[model samples]
Target: MNSNNDVIRKLHELTEADMSEAEFLQSVENNMIPMQQFFTYYRCAIMEIETKFRVLNEQFSLNGESNPIEFIQSRIKSYGSIFRKIMTNHIPRNVEAIERDINDIAGIRVVCSFVQDIYRLADCFLRQDDITLIEKKDYINNPKPNGYRSLHLIVAVPIFLENEKRLVKAEVQLRTIAMDFWASLEHKLRYKKDLPPYQLNLLADDLKKCADQSAEWDRRMQDIKNILESN
Candidate 1:
């Protein structure tokens, strides 16, 4: 279930005299259905991973331990976004190049209650024999230049097709609730193109402060949880 309303609206905005609006709309409608269907595998991969996390949460609950994971989110990149990425990166416009060059086409975000939980679930997830760890970037341990903090993992998981199994890559971002807050705000600010450089730098510095404070809070909260559990 995808909406072509956005595509149709965008195309109308860019309408030119030479192009037939009726023909162009029909062409877009024709093209969008297949593109939407092509990403079905990615969605399946997301569902598989989401299910794994949910199962893990339930197990922890059964054991009388706290469930670290708060919620999960998944997304498959839109065709327009993929096209822009290909153009920006100069990647060949083909299925092979798209898979080879774009690892974040399919993404999942896991928000946890504590910093320790982030590492704990990630370790457990990657330790599974079926999930192949392709790459990892620990921004939580080493914050990004813009003061963004999250653990990013690129893993290849097998998607069982009707004919065969296809391994697809999905980028997972694991972060604490505090980190998610800062990141959400940072992302909102980042897309505000009209902001002047000085203001942007100030915002970046402020975000750094917030990130540090959040990290400290994570440490103290985890310590408190540890103390309470020891009783």
Candidate 2:
């Protein structure tokens, strides 16, 4: 694998220096194997993290506590998306560079029942010794200008291969059910290329209002849950 990457690095250097289309294609073909290997490692890391969440949910059930996590979704970035990012970011065309820079190449979305549940689950997950927190963005508290609300965490987990233990990074997005619903709709509508600028602005404003309402709903639901627990 090392020899293959070394060769690929040389090819990448040539490509940077304006290699022909045939040479570029050859470099891509050579990169395919190592790229797939890196993706496999990322998938393994996702499995490890998902299993941890599942265990946490089960423990909550066993202790007569409602499960915090509603559902989990995991995915690897598609080749087209990866290539677009590499070109747009001017990143080195190598597996190592991609693995180091593309933190969201492997992603896991965890939707919870309430706002508090999101934080609770995150704290519990991060407390584990093996899970390394690389970066955190608290969008729930400090939402985006478009009113997006979610806790984004870039975490590293060790995936044991046949002869090596490699640490892989994955982005974990935690949000409440309401927030997720609003985000899903917003995402679907945001990409309507047919919409004119004025219409798009109007749609954005509506989505922002909806996001605020969703956040309020989450707060109310959390308060009710707290009241019930206190009783």
lDDT of each: 0.79, 0.83
**Tens-digit lDDT track for model 2 on 1-231?**
578645554434442355443443343533554544767888998999999999999999999998888999998776655665676577887666777888998899999998888888999999999999999999999999999999999999999888988999999999888988998888777656566789989988988998998888888888999999999
Native RMSD of candidate 2 (Å): 8.5
The total of clashing pairs for model 1 equals 0
Per-candidate alpha-carbon RMSD to the true structure:
7.2, 8.5
Best by lDDT: 2
Q: What is the TM-score of each candidate against the true structure?
A: 0.83, 0.86
What lDDT would candidate 1 get against the real structure? 0.79
Those runs of model 1 whose alpha carbons end farther than 4 Å from true positions after fitting are 1-34
Cα error, candidate 2, residue 163 (Å):
0.5
| Candidate 2: stretches off by over 4 Å | 1-33
